[model samples]
Target: GGGWCSSDETCTYRLTNGLGSSKYYNETVFFGEIKSTNKTVNPDFYNWNRIVVEYCDSSSFMGKANHPKIISRGAQIFYAVMEELLEKGMASAKN
Candidate 1:
């Protein structure tokens, strides 16, 4: 089966494009459900401050490749994001 980038060649291609990088990301994005601003639609989580972590590593947040060309640090990214969130009130969240 084909994956996002099966080989170094394809991964290199992804690295240059928007798939493995965030250089072409938009400044704003809107999500539904928990991240939604509509209280009627989101109900429980509408008023909570939300963040949308961009998936730019192309490794499903589980890779830690030490390649010379491609810097696949998905695990590090996940932990860093979690730490930041914890520092920013998530440590006190009941749910």
Candidate 2:
């Protein structure tokens, strides 16, 4: 277990294990949509963000893009969409 403290509160943490890559899952979905359009897609969609939610066990799900709480890791899911976005240059520094 791990512990952390903030100006407001202290919290305890433990690791949770899960399967598959949430980042790859979300990226695949987004790229799939883009490829489906034969690369004639709008740039607006590229700016839009996506998330992959890790459900019970090793299961995963995708929620709406740019919406709040689209992804839930619970300290389990291995990949994070935000990290992927930054690495892929899909999101800007201002974002």
Candidate 3:
């Protein structure tokens, strides 16, 4: 009725944060490996949902006395994994 999927289940994800405070020129890097336990369904079903990675910075030369700037990065590998699952026709699109 409201959200797409219920929280009745949990997913496992491995991630890396390579954006190691490159304040000299504002640089960031990250990657993740995600897997779901709902083996009954295919990975392609999670296409609509995404893992949003956010970054914040404040109390800096530019962020001084201001709210931390926020940026969101989306998942990349998930879709590729999903595409592969769909090829087998075992995956379905989810809202």
Candidate 4:
């Protein structure tokens, strides 16, 4: 229900429920980074769950595989997280 955005474009966001306190809590974070260019266009996105998907293919977009390949671990991880979120009902916008 709460979040923060980075002021610098190169900086990444880290989520925490508490700040300026003596205690620290451990939790998983999603979409921790919002590139500077993206932030400039949608500052309000800081308030929402932000996912920065990376393309691991070494070649140009056209050279990329059309389907999920074994080497596409990044995509696999992303989908796994999405599935888990959906299963837990945490992916809902109402949350």
Identify the candidate with maximal TM-score.
Answer: 1
Clash numbers, per candidate: 0, 0, 0, 1
TM-score of 1: 0.80
Which regions in candidate 2 have their CA more than 4 angstroms from the true location?
A: 1-35, 39-79, 93-95
Better of 1 and 3 by TM-score: 1
Q: Which portions of model 4 show Cα errors greater than 4 Å?
A: 1-43, 57-70, 73-75
- lDDT of residue 44 for candidate 4: 59
Q: Of models 1 and 3, which has the larger lDDT?
A: 1
Which of the predicted structures, 1 or 4, would earn the higher TM-score when compared with the native? 1
The local lDDT score (0 to 100) that residue 84 gets in candidate 4 is 76
Q: Per-residue lDDT for 9-50 in model 4, tens only?
A: 211122122321113433544443453235655585656654
Candidate 3, residue 54: the lDDT equals 28
Clash tally for model 3: 0
How far residue 67's Cα lies from its native spot in candidate 3, in Å, is 22
Candidate 1 CA-lDDT value: 0.79
The list of candidate 1 runs beyond 4 A from truth reads: 1-3
Model-by-model lDDT, in order? 0.79, 0.35, 0.31, 0.38
> How do the predictions measure up, each by TM-score?
0.80, 0.23, 0.20, 0.28
lDDT of 3 by residue, 1-93 (tens): 011211212100111221212233334433233433343444544334443322322111122221133322223334545566777564665
